[model samples]
Target: MSDVGDCLFCKIIAGEIPSKKVYEDDSTYAFADIQPKAKVHVLIVPKRHYATVAELAQNDPAELSHIVGVAKSIADDAFHGAYRLVFNTGEDAGQSVFHVHAHVLTGEVLAE
Candidate 1:
């Protein structure tokens, strides 16, 4: 797992790396995915780095809830509240970045 010092999402949150920001608050940051999977594919992440969703949930569930709220807001604005929230927990689950994030997919009808 990548540490905060080398985490890509950490850099984006810290403004060390450029991102197409969609929404932000004291605890969360939402930005467009570099490789979008949907018409409106945004990644919502906590400002604090957590290796996985399990870790985040175990440590700070409120922040996880806040991230979901932010994702809902983004989806609501982008596609009338129809969206899919995805959390890839680990490397085997396709979580490329160690920092916990939610993939908000919306703006079109999604596959089941």
Candidate 2:
């Protein structure tokens, strides 16, 4: 997928906006959520813009794997090896942000 010209996540990765970053590499970045939904809420995003998980999955397998791998490490550190990781796929799934990201949420168990 091609980059979105004005995606907020892209801007964040470019240091255009302030974010509490946890991890960063050439292809991905993980950061603390501005409005966290859990005691530990972090968003792991790709440095390159992809509008949705499907897009990322279809177009960039290597980058996607790296992104998830980094997210796992973040989750392990944040929750000490226990946490729930989520991806809001599209608008109907509560994906307010168009940027593709994985949500590592933990601290308190959210009843399934």
Candidate 3:
């Protein structure tokens, strides 16, 4: 697998940084967010070194879909209810990590 030298998500997926993994496959890796916005917040990251979803979508559309698929399945199984899939494209959009990832957020308010 290719890795960006300073990418935090890469480090996490590489097992150098500790993370609570929710799901993992050849193409994607899902783990709990350290700074969660909701009670159940997980980050689904692509193993490849795409800086943003737009990049992933343009270069590897199938991998992008796989990330979303994993996000859907993990969110459904973990929350057993509705969840939000969020992609922050840039720093202004609240993307602290540059690695391409989708955030799965399930909230009590969503169920209400």
Candidate 4:
């Protein structure tokens, strides 16, 4: 898979950085977000690095689908089949990590 230089998520995927991996496949990786916003917060990413969803959309349709599909599986298996999926595309949207990722959120933490 293609990785970006100095990308945090990329390092996590490559085993250079440790992460609490929840799920992984050839095209995607899922893990707990270090800074979580909900009780069950997981971040799902495409194996190939993309700074934003827009970038990912331009590169591979199947990659995008794989990321979302894995996120769905995470919720279905761990979060009782209910969760919110979020994507922060740019600086204005609070996207700290440049690589594109989908956040899976569930439980009362978000209700507060």
Candidate 5:
């Protein structure tokens, strides 16, 4: 796990930083991405900070699954459950934020 104090997603979850919230629950927070790649792009992050999806999975599989559930719910509301869930594990993979998050992208036909 990474230091939650410096994690951007953690700060958003803590209300230290403002975000366009889409959904929130006891274990997850979903918000609009500042730089969206799709028409409906939301980031679903766990309240507990984990540096990567692998880290989150190793520590708590249920939490990781919960994030997916959140993503599915977001898609269901936005575009009839048609969406893509993505996780960029490393910096090289375009994971700008260190905290693990699922990108919920929908509202259009995404490219393969």
Candidate 6:
């Protein structure tokens, strides 16, 4: 496993940073956002580090699928048919954390 050094999501995955965990499996995890933008704001992250969507390797498709699948499941279960999945690729796209994550946002119309 990758060391949870300065990575916030890594810390969350390792039980260092406390989060309102929603879902977790061997390779992925989901939790509520510390700073929520909607009534339902969950972050789905992978156990391994992948800096951003643009940086994701083709070999990591399964891991990516697992993260996205978890996010979709959370949206289906918690939001109950209304949610949007967003992946910010880099700083220009509002990606604050380097670790790859899918934001499952719902309960309000988000500005495009």
TM-score of each: 0.97, 0.89, 0.90, 0.89, 0.95, 0.85
Question: Sort by TM-score, best first: what order?
Answer: 1, 5, 3, 2, 4, 6
The digit string of per-residue lDDT tens for model 6 on 31-60 reads: 999899888898988888888865554658
Q: Which scores better on lDDT, 5 or 6?
A: 5
- Point to the candidate with the largest TM-score: 1
Query: What tens-digit string does per-residue lDDT give for candidate 5 at 7-112?
Result: 8888999999999999999998999999999999999999988899999999999999999888888899989999999999898998888999999999888999
lDDT of 2 by residue, 2-108 (tens): 24777788888988999998898888899999999889888999887888888899999898889778867876776776777788887898888798999988767
Candidate 4 has a TM-score of 0.89
TM-score for candidate 5: 0.95
TM-score of 6: 0.85
Candidate 2 least-lDDT 10 residues: 1-10
Specify the poorest-scoring 10-residue window by lDDT in model 6.
50-59
Local distance difference test, candidate 2: 0.84
Tens-place lDDT digits, model 4, residues 1-112: 2347788888999999999999888888889999888888999989887889988988897898877778777778776678888999888888989999999997543563
**CA deviation > 4 Å runs, candidate 4:** 1-3, 107-112
lDDT of 3 by residue, 20-49 (tens): 998988888889988888888999998888
- State the local distance difference test value for candidate 5: 0.91
Kindly report which residue stretches of model 1 are placed more than 4 angstroms away from their true locations once superposed. Answer: none
After superposition on all C-alphas, the RMSD of every candidate to the true structure, in Å, is 0.6, 2.1, 2.9, 2.8, 1.3, 2.8
Pairing residues by index, what is the TM-score of model 1?
0.97
Which regions of candidate 3 fall more than 4 Å away from where they truly are? Answer: 1-3
Off by over 4 Å in 6: 1-4, 108-112
Native-to-model Cα distance after best TM-score fit, residue 23 in candidate 4, in Å: 0.5
Residue by residue across 1-112, what tens digits does model 1's lDDT show? 9978999999999999999999988889999999999999999999999999999999999999888888889889999999999999888899999999999999999989
